[model samples]
Target: MNPLRLSPSRVNDYLNCPQLYKYRAIDLLPEEISLDAERGTLVHTILERLFDAPAPTRTPELAFALLPTSWEEQLIARPGLREKVQNDKEWIDRVRALLTTYFTLESPATFEPTEREVHVEVNLTESIYLHGYIDRLDIAPSGEVRIVDYKTGKSPKPGWEEKALFQLWIYAFIYWRTMGVLPKLLQLIYLGNGELLRNAPTEADLLRTEKKLISIAEEIVYSIENVSWRPRPSRLCDWCSFKNICPAFAK
Candidate 1:
């Protein structure tokens, strides 16, 4: 009867650095929510309102203006990012344009929605874990569902598909189990570039995902018993926020 539901993000932490995961999750370090995370929240809020609001009420241009300048401005605080965000003004504009495009690309005939925030608490055999709302969910006339996740970040690569894309699979399974209908699309809409990545999971696809999830969970649980771990050093060390305290990066 454990009320714990796991998400891909928690797994990502263990994958990134187990020691860091221990400090944050077990020791309960004071959480430092990043500016990027905050911006993501804001973007999610705006999109949810736009998509879930009545069809007549949706306005992409309005959401663009609605984004708080303070939150957008605060992205300056990240190291080596003040100039990067500032330089990305054009990029932001392009992203805004893409949002508008989504509205046009999906409105007037797209499934009527009010952008309602949908959160699901799955018992999972009385293990009460929660999954947050998808950025947008469109239920088409054919009873097929589409789960959209908004990503403003730049594309990680041409090889992201094979390299353990746990999140999308999690969402796909969640949608399938929660809603009886099959998903027509599980999409990552890169708001910045209007790029879309999608997958429709088969039984085999999901079985592989389940295996991967279980493997990562086992690693995380094993790391919890001890504390002798350190940062992953290499080029990524230069960018890790934990470098200030990481043994591997000790100068």
Candidate 2:
């Protein structure tokens, strides 16, 4: 029997390196998730909980104060890889300030969060299908949907608008199809730096994304069907959390 499989993040890692993907996702390696990743998860949890509360009781101010304190302690306990670039004080203060800035910048009055977690089997066609979890979906008073995905680190090619951003585009489209209404917007929040980036999803945008996904999926299916893949090395191998055990990066 085939196991339940493939979350969006895991699928992304597979795109990064199939071997590493198989080792971590399929083989189930016992590797430590990074402290930085843990920190981001913690931050998202606080922000999500803050939003998910009853509108009458929703409190972004309290959340802004509480979140960074927790994160500050976490940073102190496990400085991790960031210790070199920043001292304990700088890391804690900068993170705290960023949270304060985000609280000031974002208008919780404009919308409410519906942190959607779905593992749906989408019918891409008669034979093709897709599965993923949308991190968060928001709704405006005017009934427009919005998708927000949190990113924790600096991406090497962050400026390019088309850097495999198909994930959020598809997320927005799938959300609308499920709800029978189009999303008004989709945003990517770079939490580490508090840079909130916005993109408006149009009909043409979703169609382009759909075609791209099919192309990428076809590539994956072909490679899996024929077992046709070559090992390639790159920047990821050097800094990847899996570098210690990765065959491509092994000393």
Candidate 3:
């Protein structure tokens, strides 16, 4: 009855496993957030706050300084997180190391981002609306735009990069549709491994991605109406919070 609202993540969830999709999106079940997800949120918050200062003032040391406050708030807001951080000083060290690795790849002071964690959305069709937050957006003097996403984990291996690149393409497609300009660059920064992955999306590439997303949307709608969302068992299930209640693994 309502228009289908979707984000890149929601689409990917359905594509990965419709049953998982139904559990979270359709049934609106609750699941515990992971420590890695909490850490990623903290890192993103620190990076966003880092750029709030003048470009010259956006140094790694300042970014590091921002972490204690950011982390304290996280622990307070999510008291469950205290146990994870209380005894593990290395956890904080690992986050600081990620900040250091970020400096090695690019200087925050070099280019001021037009937006950070920007919420961008577009209506692909009358029934399908796509939306998501981009980690950062940069515009050069010459008018070229760049979309950047940060990964707290390692970069995917050779063949696995396709999925990562596909995610970028989704962002580019949404941006182009919403803004009427193709971005000059799409980048992923993997802090764990200090690796950078960049791509320049062609009009044709984004069009293909747009088509794929629409198709995915249609499939999701069909599954929801028919109550046919089925479980997809895979290695990822080991990390899935819903596994305990999942139809495929239910006791």
Candidate 4:
């Protein structure tokens, strides 16, 4: 059997609902194109390319200028995506606002990112591998590493912050296992509302995250072997694309 390939998003799918995972990861069903998700992709692309220029030139105006070309590139990659936006002008304006908010939080001209859209992969075991693309990775002058992720949406509410940080903790775990160095910081930059969430993960925290991931992977394997993919109904189901065919909602 091939090793179970897992990303933070894929793992979250399983954790959220195993049956939803089967539809996406196993059955490979097509999901409805989300305008918000596409917008996030466009913003991410512009930000990634923005760093290519000299630090002094990494200004919000430059980021705004890159929008048209970046969006055209996205249009080429996903032809059908354009139709989903009812108002092109309004949609582009929203993207511009996100870039403007980003500048207020951090001056990209001040520090250079060690990596952007960096692909990270590490094997947890012979049968399980963890991998994903990190939005940004920065190495401080003192050698402390920081993992940063950009969010086009609003920050999660107070009690749900830990749940939101779970994704980054998984990334931290992979970095530690592969690089033999624990990242000193994990940061989430919420462009929608201009809020920042930061965490300093400890060694023990990442170790627990690793164990949890292993257990989830094992559960996935067992479900595959047993041919048991059960739907988990929650408020999130309202947004799930596969709800119409979900067993839990079947009449």
Top-lDDT candidate index: 4
Clash number for each model = 6, 0, 0, 0
Candidates 2 and 3, the one with greater lDDT: 3
- What lDDT does each candidate get? 0.59, 0.63, 0.89, 0.94
Give per-residue CA lDDT, model 1, range 1-251, as digits (tens).
Answer: 24444665665666777766665556766544454555565566666656545556566656676555634554554444455455466646654665665564355234574234566434333433536555667777677777767775644578876443467677666666676555677777665555667777676776686667666665654554454455545564544556677676568
Query: What lDDT would candidate 3 get against the real structure?
Result: 0.89
Tell me the tens digit of each residue's lDDT in model 4 across 1-251: 99999999999999899999999999999998888889999999999999999999999999999999999989989978978889989998999999999999999999999999989999899999899999999999999999999999999998999889999998899999899999999999999999999999999999999899999999999999999998989998988999899999998
* RMSD, one per candidate, in order: 4.6, 4.5, 1.2, 1.0
Candidate 2 residues lying further than 4 Å off, grouped into runs, are 1-6, 54-61, 64-95, 116-121, 125-129, 154-159
Candidate closer to the true structure by lDDT (higher is better), 1 or 4: 4
Q: Model 1 scores what on Cα lDDT? A: 0.59
Q: Report the C-alpha lDDT of model 3 over 1-251, residue by residue, as the tens digit.
A: 77899888888888789999998898888777688898899999999899989999888899989999999888889867887665567888889999999999998887879989998888889998888899999999898999999999999999888788888898899989988999999999999899999999999999999899889988988897898988999998998999988899978
Candidate 4 whole-model C-alpha lDDT, 0 to 1? 0.94
| C-alpha positional error of residue 145 in candidate 3 after TM-score superposition, expressed in Å | 0.5
Per-candidate TM equals 0.75, 0.75, 0.96, 0.97
TM-score of 2: 0.75
